[model samples]
Target chain A: MPETFDSPPRFDTVLIANRGEIATRIQKACRELGLKTVVVYSEADRQAPYGKTADSALCIGPSSAAKSYLNKDALLLAARLTGAGAIHPGYGFLSENAAFADAVEKAGLAFIGPSASSIEAMGDKISAKRAMIAAGVPCVPGPDTALSDDPAAVERLALEIGYPVIIKAAGGGGGRGMRVVPEAGLLQEAVALTREEARQAFGSPSLYMEKFLQHPRHIEIQVLCDTHGNAVWLGHRDCSMQRRHQKVVEEAPAPGISPDVIRPVGRACVEACRQIGYQGVGTFEFLYEDGAFYFIEMNTRLQVEHPVTEMTSGIDIVQAQIKVAQGDPLELAQADVKCEGHAFECRINAENPDTFLPSAGVITSLALPEGMGIRVDTHIHAGYKVPPYYDSLIAKLIVHAPTRAEAMARMREALAGTRVDGISTNIPFLRALFEDSAFTRGETDIHYLEQWLKQRRAP
Target chain B: MSAIDFSDPATIAFLTEALTAAGASGLEISWPGGRLRIVIATGNEAGVDVSVTPRPAPTAQPLVVVKAPMAGHFYPGSPSRQAATDRLPSVLAADILGFLRVGPLLLPLCAGRAGILTKQLAEPDALVGFGDPLFEIEPQS
Candidate 1:
């Protein structure tokens, strides 16, 4: 039965259960939709500028993340106290937590994301891979089952898949609790170690193995789905500039890849979202190698790199996610989706440009670039204290132009003009990176940043 | 013949320095019912004088704070109840000074010590997190 507009659940106020730039971003979206926003914060973020602008701001807990941002009970209590009818988890923290989503729904509030069941299904690597394969989304060659405890069977499976297999925890993501076995001799130890780590970390010892690609680009397809079963892919992003498994920079339309190659992948992502009954915004991460796409996992939340796709597709993804949460059907069909121009997003992190250690202090002075086709999403200003307790990403500097070269040039100009005083930033490193010949050429693999850093460090 | 600890040069020096830093002419601190006074001379070449006396009777105890044990809406009493003034009633250590209403569960706010509830710190029904002060208690004998 289709949900009619009159019968659909509607909410007037949204409690933003996250912090930093995403909180500011969500608040903007809510205000534009004529919905009131309640910004909840930890003690450390009591003075956050967004809090002052929100309809209602409350301190939920102390400075520690576990007691504040990650506290499910505290978040629910805040939502109830503020009279908010819906919650926008933003990203990170409890955004991907299935139990929290279920709790919010049980509390008679809308969780502005996918249903808990979809999150649970995709949270497990084994089940997620099976679902992708069943949906005709390309996946790495491996059995969609946990590795057996029998050492001989594990070795046989590894041998069948060829050497250089990766044993990953079924319950782990974000590049943790995984091990790579370059040869047969190290397979058992790697599995045992990863299994033990997984059990301790994710409370699951179930492990799976897959063929580890040596040189694959990190390309991801962004999709938006509604409760009415409509889904569309909003182009693709190449977040191949990474350091320590974290993306430093991202660009849309993945330079050098023709639309013919990525069109099928995008369609498959949309199909997968529809098959799983997924709703709201999500990303289907893939490893691109040898002109083929292999599904890695699906992030059932708004990604940090979503702005790049938003710039190219000219879509307000956050607002779309909110509308879908309100039981509204997608306003645009697949045929209406058009990705134009080239866009780049540089994650400005508060860290030492050399050592990459977090630098937390007051932003004594600030200057950000402003021009046509440039957007800066940030929750900071002069005198805003960068708290050390949270993620180091202080802002996202995005630029879009008619061509990739122009976008790169604009980014270089933006980086040069950007200045954050009283703390170290990765601005200098980013400036140098934008000038690199290889990066300007595009199509760098996921390991390019680390190798480049190493080359720079060598005497 | 005074019971002052003249044997410990460090104690006398510390007292002398504290008195000089505070810009007080003299200070008399008593222990075991005996008082020792250090007086500073006005001249550039300052001098000190020590004397002893008997101590006086003790005074009243200090005030204590009643804090919220958890985060929730604070209620001074039941919804139907009313108070004549903002002042809170005297409370026992285990008395229910207020309640932290967390989703239909009201956890009692205990004074945790005997005292006169002199002031209500938080507004009634205000959302407060853990450790927020709800009432100020003047400890009684």
Candidate 2:
């Protein structure tokens, strides 16, 4: 077989096959790198600020994501019509899609992320855990093999792994198609229920088992690799401030975890990247509990929380990813990389503050916070419609300072400065959360945010 | 005083019934400087909203529908602009204007009607769907 990482790619244009904040973010990166960008938007995003700013913007389909952002064929067709040399999935829609990545490469276009094989490897939790273990990365204890139909085998494995195990579908992610078993008595029923749910949700019956850890924090290491045999870990992030398993707030250099503790694991992630010949940017998500790291999965695309890492390290991750796709070698070694400051990213979603239900309407007025060390990544403007058909995230308000306390203070000020009118926003909720004593202390875990909300809501 | 949420099934059904009651199989919803014409498909039993307009939002420029000759990736230019202009502006009726490379074969796509090429609607080296626009032409009378 030919060497996968051969010659460098030569391209000056990229098609952004996404909408909202990430689309604008990718376009800015492309422009800074002297690359032209073509933006493909749905009808709902007709008046989006990013579309007008792009070199070329085209309407792909209707507002429904199925016809617009997730329409693989339409996106590819848009790329073809626009003369884009490559396509940037931009974190959502088709970002983690293995088949879409394969199709892009097969159609003689560069996929601005990891190879299809790498994506496929990480797509399945079972295969990903096994790979991570092989690469000497710490993982939650569980049977590595795929689940069998035999009841005896399932029960034996569950007993061996101990109680409170989680039965997860191979194709599951984003807290879907999983069941937690507290005891052996409920094991079979949980497995059977999860299998049916998996078949309906992810179209896959393949299931995997893992030792469920309570109160584990969601930490992730950011890695950037090139076509050449070079990789660098860009430090860690704590996305534990989540509601309903969806991240609402993220911060770089996860609070309280010393560099000495995370460094080795980060190095292991870099080694795994090189071992797999991974290209572009990828994130290794881990569950941190009892001062130990357990690999969960790898996001083979630019993460939404990338800005927090960028703010702390002063590294333009999107630009770096684009450069890697352009066949650039690693400019700096592991030693050259150093995180200087603390950074936080608050996802400003267009949703109800109470129920968290998506609130869609025209943003009649928008007053975005702006100042030194504060960055707002968004595609929304005054009069921009917050469509109900897609993710509720409207913008990412990021702030960086010398210390975590300073960063938090800066975030509070920034949050106060933000004002979105004619539509409900979660700004009020974020403001309260920032003022909370536990959140300010940075001792919260994955379930902390939900629990906090419940406590606040208690009559 | 209120805007309609088109995605709601109730709104869609109401709109369909309203249109049918008005003795119009087709209805055009117009906002300030924008228009959306919904036509009832010929054979669709339930009057499916499949016939949606292909407008690129509201712009000041006069709308000109650019029709694609064949399905392929839209490429605005071949090698260079000089090359594109030389081949495009001087092409006769029978001449091969440009090629749309579908996989391996370079299929020849022609300028069916004589006109001044106002704009190249598609991007260079882009994959185009069947009947998707490639170029905008100002027809010579």
Candidate 3:
């Protein structure tokens, strides 16, 4: 076992346990905070540029994520061997994995994220909704109780919630294990089909029901909390531009919505975190329709689009998360948080822009935009190989400006300046989206991206 | 690069056979960085000869590749600072060499067959996804 860093030991080094852009992003945060970083890589990512810049780098495992990033034992051992005091699971893989967090904490090293229990609770959609309701947070019209096997009770409950309800699995998230019931007659059949699918997909036949909003916009509130019971919401972002539930673009201070409209929701989310003693950075996702926000699932980890909120609020969220993990108090209060500008983030993925198929190969040449209000979070460079084994996301091009229009304009300029060769990317699609009138006016819903893509691809 | 279809049993089986025949003592291939060789062994056990018969690299052309057996972070030394026995300079094949820690317990990260070169892949502690590289070795004459 590695020696524990007790007695108020100052942590000067962090071991990043994931790969790609998030790894580079976390390393930058650590460097800004004057901390050294230790990076690990798989065989497939041997030429990653981020490894070259790290204070120390090592080969952990093979290209498969299961043996590399997901190997909890290996990560702890690295921290033990390198004298690293903390492990930052940037996102995906083991970021929200409760067991990994528990193991890290048991090894006497800080897990730079939420507590294991919080992760467990929020990882399950039903449990999270229950917790949110318990803390007086508004949830969608869904019963807190699990669905019964009785078809009659299921039909009765669906009637009470009204028609056009959605049947969802308790263990489901990311829009899986769900089926929409259009009317009263379809409720029972939907329930049965969803139960079977949920059982097959989530390993649980248990499910819940909710009113399926046809054109709801996706909005989310980012929250930060310390171990000292202090928690605050760090503005909001609109992630309505999605394809099949996966967010394609996100912007902060969701355009056109007044602070009054979102203030109560944000407060409720913060209160929920405090009530549950939640720690680290988290996101409360919601569906906004009919001018009211309906609570959805909570993500108990740093979100991918966190850069947008960071740009708008000018807060180093990753640094704050690390500080919180090190048992530090919240330095800035809710009142101290002053969101100054609008920000937008476009996820640049290596894929077929038309079919959205992943495109993997070595980057022959690359150029990223520089200057004020423009930030590129990525690990790719000229000659860096984009391995086909993992996610297609290659970079996140984010911009901040005094106004939404200015931010949009800056994104246009930044996108034009950026160039990545030897692999197909979504840059062209994003550039075209920026020119769309609906997108410019912020008058689009969750289905807008898919619909736009459909129209563009139609013969 | 072509995507290795891991879902197909044939890929895994072929890889297992190819790895065994590579006779590179041990080889470490990493994503982000590419490949590394750490020759910790001497004689026939220490290397893999790609040009000739699929036999391990002979000492006359000392070159051993230390490939990762699984995916995880790779460590090259022991916890205590006695500075573990060096793998370079081609020690006897029976010599006890460096280690790789998975989490708590230390797993002996061997140089199995021997050689002289000690090239490393992945970093000292970066998160190496599966099949990442660790070391490469070129045997001594």
Candidate 4:
């Protein structure tokens, strides 16, 4: 049943402030909602299929991301020019930028995500930890405050938290602006270097310390919330396959974890959202080790690896986010949420299989998998030019099956059927990873991919 | 050679804006006694600045297609004047060829150099995006 909304729809048209596959994803959702779509692109993405098919496509700036996708003023101006009443900032770029969200709301446009205050609350690592603890979310053992400048005091704090602590920037994410110290000797130097880096990179030298888990597996809970204080936890995901803190592959209902162990954590994440008055979709990322979950951070936007959860949980997260932005109450309760089958998502990047350098060129030929349980979300086609200006993720290959082993087999088949010509891709690397005995047995840690790559490189 | 007064503050301003919009690393022109360069710095989100001893012209010329610096509504001329909007194929001299309106702001679209405006690619009052070709110009050789 559709809940009543007292106000008229907040937006009749949505301006997609993103590019590539995610932009294509959002446009499809808007089409289903019967809302007019406006897609913005950088000059390099002039030939993007989403832009071509959108109700109105506009190039917001030049090829440089800073001048285009990251340019907040340009995005707002584009929305105004196109008479778009809302803007959906897909993952990456300015998706989590609190200032952009505030500016969007100030411009009388829906931002299609949480309010600026909620984003700010979760953006700061220390504040986020405090919020999580308040909501009964388990966090890594550490103080919920910024580190002091006093060297002696800092050393004492480190001693209290024990060595092997990680120093992180308050305003940083995507695995940058952090330093992991394995012992006391390197603590001060690491702190100094990281603080300076944080100041230079994130515009603030404020740093915090936490116990660095040595063998934690990356896990996260997907959550959806409405403005009416109703929220639901969709399910959990295992994104342990990482290279340099970037998730290369992800799966749903993380293998081998009992539902009893994760259910409380999922409930806590939903509680955190409600406590902060969160709206729209978000991900509560964690580091799990020894059957325990530690809250890390909350990505206050739609995640790149959301498809695996969508396949298992059977929800159109992007469309739900839009509906929540339009002031609609959540249509489903926690009881309606169900994780049916296992799923896997491999991020197909346009890069060298070994060196991982970005490969940008026109696709001379293309072949992607088809058939039941195999879905490839991509915006590329034959003759499509992979732009060198942005993230190298060109496509996502997702497969679902009733069991994890069957899903692995399905993914292997899909990967075998895939072919991209005229440019290098990580297809070879993904195929090789799928065959790894440890990965196949679902017994890999967050550091497993790097260790695997290191072993592969050893003579 | 052409009489492009690179020293004119208006020309420098126009060139800097154009360089930033085009994502050009920088622009350098040299002639008899002077030289001018406008660099669009990669850091700090494309901050463009030019220090000029400004005097001069060109070694070569090519057709230039002026595109929008950012997204906005494209106007062929001062909208208040009815006849100016329809006038096309006119000769331009490093001057304002059109205007791009964003709300109350009307950003002048300059040609950057002397040329014959051969075509207007965008419709009057049309919402044009960045890098949308607005005018085609054949520069004087």
Among these predictions, the greatest DockQ belongs to: 4
lDDT score, candidate 1: 0.89
Candidate 4's residue-wise lDDT over A1-459, tens digit each? Answer: 123323424889999999999999999999999999999998899999998889999998889999999999989988988999999999999999999999998898999988888888889988999999999999998888999999999899989999889999998888999999999999899999999999999999999999999999999999999989899999999999999889999999899999999999999999888888888999999999999999999999999999999999999999999999999999999999989999999999999999999999999999999999999999999999999999999999999999999999999999999999999999999999999999999958999999999999999
DockQ for each numbered candidate: 0.28, 0.09, 0.21, 0.61
**Model 4: residues >4 Å from true position, as ranges?**
A1-9, B1-62, B78-90
Q: For candidate 3, write residues A1-459 as lDDT tens digits.
A: 112223223477899998999999999999998989988777787778888899877666778888777888767766776778888999888998999998888877788888888898888888888889988888999798799898888888888998789999998888899998998887788888999998999888889988889998999999998887889999999999998888899999898889998999999999999877788899999999988888889988889999999998889999999888878889999999999899999999999887889999989999999989999999888988899999899999999999999999999999999999999998999999999989999948899988998999899
Each candidate: chain B TM-score: 0.54, 0.43, 0.43, 0.49
Among these predictions, the greatest lDDT belongs to 4
Go through the candidates in order and give each one's C-alpha lDDT.
Answer: 0.89, 0.83, 0.81, 0.90
- The TM-score of candidate 2 is 0.79
Each model's total of backbone clashes: 0, 10, 81, 0
Error of 2 at A44 (Å): 1.7
lDDT of 2 by residue, A195-279 (tens): 9999999998999998999989999999998888899999999999998889999999899999889999998998787777788
What docking grade applies to model 1?
A: acceptable
Model 2 in CAPRI terms: which quality? incorrect
**Ten-residue region with minimum lDDT total, candidate 4 chain A:** A1-10
Q: Clashing residue pairs in candidate 4, if any? A: none
